[model samples]
Structures are given as C-alpha cells and as structure tokens.
Target: MVSITFLGTGGGRFATIYQTRSTGGMLIEDRGRIHLDPGPGALTNMARLNMDPGFTDAVLISHCHPDHYSDAEVLIEGMTRGGINTRGLLAGSVSTIDGIDGIRPAISDYHRQLPSRVLSMRAGDEADIAGMRTRFTPTRHTDASGVGAVFETSAGTVSYMGDTAPREEVTASHEGCRVLILNVTRPFGARLRCHLCSEDVPAIVERLRPELTVLTHMGVKMVEQGPEEQALRLERMTGSRIVAARDMMRLDIGDSLRVNAPTLL
Candidate 1:
C-alpha cells in the first residue's frame, strides 16, 4: 500500500505568513519515505506527529519558493543524522538546486553535501527515487525551471502538479495517474499568473479524469472562501472525486483509495 500524509495545505505569501493552513508539505511512504516540498511548518509538524525526519530517504523540492523549500535544509540535516552520515537523496529543480537567473539556491552548499546524491532535475528527466520510478514533469510557473513529478508506486501512479498555471503540457504529463495533487493557490474568479485557481480545475479534471483529484496549497482567499466549498463546486463541474486536502490528512492507496481525516495536534 502507498500512503500519503499531507503536512500542510496552505500556500501563497499571505496564507503562509498567517498560516491559515499549515505549510509543511506531504510525506509519501512506499518503498521508502519521501518528504515532498517541506516548507515552514514541516519540521515542527513532523515532530508533532512523531515522524522522524531521520527516516526520510529523500527530500524533494518542486521549486525555489520559500513556501515549497523553507524547511529543506533542516530536514536534510535530520536525514544525514546531523551531518554525521552521508545518506539519502536530495532532488530539486534547477532553480531550487543551482539558482536560475538571479534567484539564489534554496539549499546551502554545506547542506547539499550532506545528501549522498543530489540530482538537479529538469522536465522529462527520469530517476529512481526511493525504489520508485519518478519522472520530472514541466510546469508553467514564474520559476521557469520549476517542475512537477509523477511517481510510479506499487499501487499506482501518483502525480504532483507543482505550482503551475493550467497548461496543456501540464495535463498531458500527468495523464493516467491514479491520484493527482494540485497546488491550487487561488479561489474561484481569483486566477493569477503562475498559479492554479479553483476555476481552472474542471477542464484539467475532464482531460485526465484521474480516480482522485486533490486540491491543496490554498491561498488566503481560497482559505477564506473555503477549500471544501470550492472542491464541491469543482466536483460538480468535473464529475470526479475532488477532495480539498487539510493539513495532516492521510490518503491510503491500495485496492481502493481511502481518505483519513486530519487529526489536528
């Protein structure tokens, strides 16, 4: 079975600052544990849940945005046992790993050396991560080099659509996945450049028609308007199972996908 635990659900500048929802990212447990896009509350939330960062086999950052990579260095320290051991894989976009344009790298050089292997990923790149076949997918975001990912797990394919605007390539890259995770940072009628809005979901869902579509990484407006209500409206329009993920919610994928409600700490 493949299990995914959502550590945080909030995104955007204000939402992260105010913490309308947590910004810890998600944890995937399959062949090995992977913490994806660990942001501000990632380490704290992991401690709250008694999840040892030392067990994390890999840490993946989709982009260089602080909301996506803030806690990465600290987590790398944990993964390497306070830098006492060189273990685990560290993967991120070119922008996140090497700094594209004028943007600075998210991880420091010291932290970079801690991971046994550091992969600078680009769209269409394929890698074996934590015993799963992973593909880097393209994204139309402010960070030109930013990428999403598709993981071929034992149960099925799980795709993470990183902070991206609705684009044909984005949909095409994630086709046929059993579970689709979207970083929806805007509410209905509040679309913005480089981010997914509630209004943009129907068409994407119609095209891919995955078994489950998860809405997460909500902005302040989305949080105020309510993610659940937006998800419900999108589900009606798309005729698919669309869930608005809450911080700490878990999804177990096996013969069937089971959503375990969040238990706030």
Candidate 2:
C-alpha cells in the first residue's frame, strides 16, 4: 500500500532546538518515494529513522524558505547515487530552483544536472512525474511567488500547505483531496501572521473536508501547548479525524492512515 512518512513535524528555524521531534516534512512512498520539503534536519532525521534518501525518485519543494528547501541539493546527490546520473524528478518553486541574490541555487551544477526533468513553478502549474501528477498550488505567503504543491498520487490526492495564512483559493486548489497537510504553526488559541492556528483548522476541515487532516509545520509554542491534545480538539470541532504529526511517523493511503515506524536504528 502507498504510504506517507512525516519526516519532521516542527516548523521554522527554532525547530532545531525542538529536536525532540523533527521539522523536515513528509515522504510519500508509492511506486517510488517522493520527499517533500527537506528542511534543516531532513536527511539526518531520515537516517535516524532508518529511511534511505537514495530510495527516492523525486524531491518536491514548496518554496525557498530554509526550513523547507535547505537540504534538497544534498538529498538530490544521494538520490542520484553521488551524481552518477540525472534520473529522478526535481520540482520546486521558481525561487527555490533559481537563486535570488545568489542564495537559492543551493544545489551545485553537478546536482542540478541529476534530475531527469526539473520543473520550476510559482503556483497553478502542474507537472507529471513518472506516473504521479503534481500541481503547484498558490498560497498567500511571500516567497518570490508564493507556492505550495498538490500531489495526485496513485493512492489519492494530497495538498501540502507549505506556509501561509488562510486564503480563499488554497483549499479550492485541492477541491476533492483525501489528504491535506497544512503548516499549522500556532496552537488552538494564539493568533499570528502568515501562519495557521489550530482554531483555523475546522474551517479548512469543513471546507476541503479531506478524509484526514494533518497538522504539521508546528512550532515550540504548539509543542509546549501539546500538539496531540490540540489535534484532539480540532477533531472535536471539525468532526473530522485530525492528527498532529510526529517526526518519522508513517501513514498509508485512505481516510484512516495506518501508522508504521521506520526500522529501529
């Protein structure tokens, strides 16, 4: 069965200190493993969890933010077996792919040449990777062009909200998605800018009404507040099964995602 692995559940730079958990993001393993948003501790966390980067077929970045795209180039090298070939797909936002002020061309020439195909998109653009379909969905945050990705996998459709405040169009992009992964950085009570609070989850759940709603990209505040309890609250309010993600957690496709732990390291 197809499965999604939560490599990291924290968000922002502070996530490093909150290393009791990880903030790297998710991995979708179907016909091939697809890593999304390889943040600060992604590769390391994967190793800790006993998952291999060389097994990946593609890496998708939502934006150029350090917490979202930092380790991509390094991960790419692993995927290509130390730059021996350019076979896997590399998809990222425009800013993430092309450097701005010489910052984001993060990967070297040898690495960029490894992807069999590379797609640089800002949002509202779709590309087919092998058999999986990916669409760059729009968001309200500022990131050169502000983009996120919606993956139409063989199992089901998923919309990963990289970073953004609630926007009218964000949910519509994945109108009938079965899984929606949102970067919920705040707890049930706090109010913030360009980030989502637990209170905002029900609206998304009611609107998109995905089979399962995943709360990710959390922060220390949320961690201290206890994401698990807040997820339970969100479920109570939305009447949808809501899950607060943990680093290295795995889930299979469908309304109820079965959990699997990486092999003990």
In TM-score terms, which candidate is top? 1
- Judge candidate 2 against the unseen true structure and give its global Cα lDDT, from 0 to 1: 0.79
Instruction: Assess each prediction's global lDDT (C-alpha) against the native.
Output: 0.94, 0.79
- List candidate 1 stretches off by more than 4 Å: none
Clashing pairs in 1: none
RMSD to the hidden true structure, all candidates: 0.7, 2.1
Stretches off by above 4 angstroms in model 2 are 17-20, 100-103, 254-256, 261-265
Poorest lDDT segment (10 consecutive residues) of candidate 2: 256-265
Root-mean-square deviation of candidate 1: 0.7
